[model samples]
Target: MPQESSHADPAPRLHRVVVIVDANSNPFELSCAIEIFGLSRPELGRELYDFALCAAEPHTVMRDGFFTLTGVAGIDAADTADTLIVPNRPDTHVPRRPDLLDAVRRAHARGARLVGFCSGAYTLAEAGVLEGRRATTHWQWADGFRARFPGVRLEPDVLFVDDGDILTAAGSAAALDLGLYIVRRDHGAEVANSVSRRLVFAAHRDGGQRQFVERPVPEVPDESLAPLLAWAQERLGEPLTVADLAARAAVSPATLHRRFRAELGTTPLAWLTGERVTLARRLIERGEERLEVVARSSGLGTTANLRARLRRDTGLSPSAYRRRFGTAVG
Candidate 1:
C-alpha cells in the first residue's frame, strides 16, 4: 500500500491515479473521473492526487471518432497508480478488449484499488475481478449484465457498491457519487464536502437508484419541503422536534413523515439529527470552541452526547475530527 501524505509537511506526496479508456469509452464517464480525481484542488492546502489518462493503445480516437485523445500513456501506467479507474464501455453487448482486461486484472493483482463506473462494470466483469463479488451497473444494462456474467451478484438498485478493494457505480450521474465516495474514503468528509460544494452536488445523497428509476418526472422545489428545510436549518441550535417541524410546515405529523420519506428518504427526526451532526462538524472543524460549547451550540446538549453522536455520525470523537479536519490543527 502507498504511504499516506503527512499533514504536518509543507508539501505532500500525491497519490497516483490512472484512468483507462478506449475508443468506445463513454466521454461523459471519462470526464467524470477527470473532474473528480484528475483535477487539482489547491484549496485542500496540499496536493492530493497525481492523475493520468492511459489507454491500451496510444493516440486513440474516443466515442464518435470526432474527438481524439493524444499523449495518453499505455496500459503500463496502471501498474504504478494507487488507484485505477475504468470508465463506461460504449456498448455492453460487445466484447471488451483483451489487452485492457489484462491490464485491469494485473493492476488488481498488484493490489491497486480498482473502480468501474457505469457500464465500466462490464470491463471488470470481462476481466473476472467482479466474479463472486457484489456489484452494480447502469440500470438499463442490469438484466443483460446478469445474463452475461452469471457468476457476479448484481444489486441493480444502489448508486454504487464498495467492496473494499473493488468498487462499482451505477449509471452516469452515479459515477460522481462513487468518485466523491473514494475521495471521502481517502481523505475525509471535510475534503469531500469541499469538492462537492465546488461541483454544486450533494456531498451525500440519500436513498438508492430506485428513486431515480421509479420516478422519471423531475421534482419541483415548491412540491418539496424546501422552505421548511431552510427554516429548520437556521434553528438547528434549538431542540426541534418532528411535531415542531410538522406545525411549521402546516401539516399533520403523519403527513410530514410521508413527505420526508418521499423527499429525503429519511424520517423527520433522523433528518433533524443529521442536520445537528452536520452543524456540530462545522463547529468542530473551526477549532475555536471547547467540546461542551460545540455540543451546546450545535444542539447536541452536552459533551457526552456530542461524543456519542460524533462517533455514530463520523466514527470519530470531537477532538479526533478536529485533528483530522480542523483548520487550526493543520
Candidate 2:
C-alpha cells in the first residue's frame, strides 16, 4: 500500500499490498493482482511488493468448485498494508462477514489506498469506503450496486473509475487496466509498460468495458486476415491504398475492404488510422520524443494530424497527452 508518487525516483520505494479474496472470488481478478503486484518485480529494477493472499475465514472455497486455502493472514494484515486490493468476491451469494467489512473500513479510515475489481466494489461499499466516491463494477451488476448503495456515485461506462484514495474497476478484463494504472501511478509509465510486456497484455484499451464487451468476434474461417493485418502494421508509415492492400492480401480491392470490415469491424483506412494513433499514444506515453517527432515516427506524418485524431479519440490533444503521460517532461 505505498502511496502513488507524483515523481517517482530512479529507484522507487517498495510497497506492501494484500489481496482480500473470498470463496466467490474470480480467478482472473486474482491473477491480475498476482501479475501486477504479487509477483517479484526485480526485472523492473524494483524490490518485491510484500504481497499476501488473505481470505475472510480460516478455510474458504473458491469459485473454481474446489474447497481450498487457509493462507488467511488475519484481518490485522489490512491494518499495516500500504495498499489493499479486493478482487471479485464470491458472487452475490453469501453475505460478507462482519470481520471482513471491519477490516476494510479500518484500512481505508487510516488513509490506505483501497481498490476493488469487478464485484469487489460491493465489499468496499459494504465497508462504507465508497460513500462519496465515483465507482463502477461489472456492467451486469450496475442495477444491483445502485440498489444496494445509493450514496455512492456510479459511473457504469468507464473501464475503471479513480476517485482519489478509492478506486474501482469494471469486470475482469478491466482489472488488468486498473492494475496497470496502479503501476503507472506508483512507478511511472515505464514500469507500467514493463509490467504489460511481462504479462503479455495491452497496456491500455481505447474505450471502456463496453468496447471490450461488445467487440465483435471475427469469423476466422477461410477468410483469416491475420497475415494482411500483420503486413499493414509493419508498413504503417507507408501510404497504403486499397489496391496496395488488395495486392498484398491476394484478393481484389473490394474483397479486401469487405474482409477488413468483417474481421476488424472497421474499413482499411479507419483501422490504419486507429493503429497510427495507438502507436503515437504509446510513444508519447513512453516519454521518448517531441510531438512532431512522435507523429512522424508513429506514421501520423504531422503533429497537427496527430493532435486532431488524438483529441477526437481521447478528448486529449497531443500536448496534453504528452504532459500527462510523458515521464521525461513531467
Candidate 3:
C-alpha cells in the first residue's frame, strides 16, 4: 500500500479543537473527530490536535429518548478551541438554544473554523453562521431545512461542503469524509490518507453527494448466512445459482428466499449480487487486474455485467473503482 509522507523534523504544537456535543449528538460523528484529531499520530511523525468534547451545560447529557448522557464536559470547554465542531442535531424543526448559538457565533468571530454534520447544520443555520452560505445536510431533511432557513443555500446530495471558514457534511458516516477532508485541507492528502488507513477505511470518498444519494444499501446478515455464505465466499470463481445455495443451506428455493429476506433484509438474488460486488471491490482494491479476470473470479461473468453492477451499486465503473481504490491499496 502507498504510505503517507513522513515529516522528519520536530512536530509542531498541536492545535486546539473542540467538538460540541448535545442531547442529540451522534456518537459516530464524535468518533470521527476522535479518530482524526484526538488520537496521537506519532507513527506519522505529525503533530496531533488537542481535541475535547464540549457541551452547553456543566454536566452534559445526550438523548437516546428515555436514556440520558452524563459525565460530559460543559460548553465552557469549547471557549478556547481553535476549531469548533457541532455534530448532527436531533431535530431540524426546533431552533438552536440561544446560548449555544451565541457560543458558536463567538467561536467563529474569534477565528475558529465551524463544522456541522448532518442535521447539525441546523445549529449553524440557527446561529446565523450559515447565512448566505452553501451548505448541506441529510437529503431527507433538505426540504424542511430550505423552508426553515431561506437564506442558506442547501445542496442536498454531497458528502460535505467546505467554504474555508465553515464546513457542513451530510448524513451519518459522511462525517468521516468531512473530518478527513478537514485534515487534508489543513495538513495534506498524505496525512489524511494515513488517518484513513489507520481507521481501516477508504482513503477518501468523492466529496460529491451524488455518491451517497443513489448507492444501494447492502443488507446482509453476518449470522444467518454463515455456512452458505462461507461456502459461497470460498468459491467466488465458480458460478453459483439459487439452487446451489438452497442445497447448501438444506432448504427449498422458497425457503432460501424467505431466509435471505428475514435474515438479510434483502432478496436472495440481491444478496448474491452484493456478494459478487464485494468480491470485485476486494480484488480491485488489492491491485490492478484485467477487468475480465476480476469479473470471472468474482462470478460477475463478464466485463459488461461487472460494469453494470459496479455502476448500479457505487455509481462508478469498474475502471473508476479501480483507479480510486487500487491506487490507495497500492
- Best-fitting candidate, scored by TM-score: 1
Determine which window of 10 residues in candidate 2 has minimal summed lDDT: 206-215
lDDT of 1: 0.81
Candidate rank order under TM-score: 1, 2, 3
40, model 1: CA deviation in Å? 2.4
Superposed on all Cα atoms, the candidates' RMSDs to the truth, in angstroms, are: 5.1, 6.8, 9.3
Question: Model-by-model lDDT, in order?
Answer: 0.81, 0.76, 0.76
Report the lDDT of model 2 for residue 61: 71
TM-score of 1: 0.82
Give per-residue CA lDDT, model 1, range 188-273, as digits (tens): 66677888887888776532434243223566545668889889989988888999999998999999988887776668988887
Cα shift from native, residue 58, model 1 (Å):
1.9
Cα lDDT tens digits for candidate 2, 1-330: 988989857765568899887776777888888888888766755454778888767777777765566767866777778899864764664578788888898888788899999899998998888887899888788988899899999998778887878888888888898888787666545566678888898664432334133335557656577788788889877777668888998899888777775554456777777778767777887775688887788788888898898887656777776677675222
TM-score, candidate number 3 = 0.61
TM-score of every prediction relative to native: 0.82, 0.69, 0.61
Which ranges of candidate 3 are over 4 A from the true structure?
A: 1-11, 65-68, 211-330
Q: Write the per-residue lDDT of candidate 3 for residues 1-330, one digit (tens) a residue.
A: 999779688665677898887766677777787887899887766455888887776544554654455666787777888989975666667666777888899998898999998898998988888999999999889889999999998988777888778999988788888888777555544466678889887555545534243224458644466688778879877888888899988889999987765554456676677678767766776673889988999899999999998886566787776665564421
User: By TM-score, how accurate is candidate 2?
Assistant: 0.69
| lDDT head-to-head 1 vs 3, winner | 1
| Pairs that collide, model 2 | 1-16, 1-82, 1-83, 24-90
